[model samples]
Target: MTRALVIVDIQNDYFPGGAFPLVEPEAAAANAAEVLGAFRAAGEPVVHIQHVSADPEATFMRRGSHGDEIHELVAPAAGEIVLQKAHPNSFLGTHLESTLRDLGADEVVVLGMMSSMCVDATVRAASDLGFDVTVVHDACAAPDLEFGGTSIPGGAVHAAFMAALSDSYATVVPAARLAQTH
Candidate 1:
């Protein structure tokens, strides 16, 4: 069971002082850093995914912008792979799947910003692609969402999405678990 860590869109835009900041981004990023450290210490594969929008009118993560850069918390080290993606699903129009395969990974460990979007999409796609998936719940963040005139708090949104993903998509666990096992 070879394993790889996929850091999905932990970019500056999701952090404080950037576009589209999410709730508890620093806390989630700290957790993600810990998991990333574990993977590095164990000599496992790590792939950093950056969301770069090509649309000129996009409010955030515009290509070549600072917001599109991956946060320093889990920045790709020299020799590590960094994949730029235009969509929430990391595998779409990206070399993520092929890269993982090339790295001999059969299982994927994912953690990053916006639990309700990229994290959700990437987890589902990984599952569909037949890779065993594990999501670090505490290592992911989410922004508050509104639906039908109801405002959903970011915490609630994150929990709801994690719950949904845990039910069928992946085995969701806290960052500490991976740290211990790593």
Candidate 2:
């Protein structure tokens, strides 16, 4: 079975001090870069999913903004596949399914921004679309949440999401483990 790497929304807007900063965005970007490198080395397909917010007031990532561009630290290679998406789920109204099909990909390694949202959405969507999904926990981030008048730590949210996701949508694994799998 062919496998592809789906990098979702590693854009400038999601980085620290950017439009919509996430927890440890820098680290996520670094791990994602390593994942990309591994995929390249293995001659596997790499798909870069760029999310552009159609909503103007949506923190950052407005259409045509620099924030919508791929983060400098995790830039894609010349021939890497790029899919521009308007929604959190990469498959929503996008050519993601067809693109993956054309590449003959039966499995996908997913990594990117906003662990509790886009990352999760993509994983679920991929699973629904019949792809074996592997989500790299260390290569994803989420904003801190607030519950019962207390701010939930980013790490807690990240871990909780990973635990939940492992049950159904995807197999949650550390970046190192996923990298070594190739």
Best by TM-score: 1
The Cα error of candidate 1 at residue 38, in Å, is 0.5
Q: Could you give candidate 2's per-residue lDDT for residues 1-182 as a string of tens digits?
A: 99999999999987766877888899988998888888999999999999987887877889888889999767888998899998889999899999999999999999998888899899999999999999999999998999899999888998898888899888888888878977
Worst 10 residues of 2 by lDDT: 14-23
Once fitted onto the true fold, the runs of candidate 2 whose alpha carbons sit more than 4 angstroms away are none
TM-score of each: 0.99, 0.95
* Predictions in order: lDDT: 0.95, 0.90
Residue 115 local lDDT, model 2: 89
Model 1: per-residue Cα lDDT at residue 15: 85
Q: Which ten residues in a row have the lowest lDDT in candidate 1?
A: 67-76
Backbone clashes in model 2: 1
RMSD of 1: 0.6
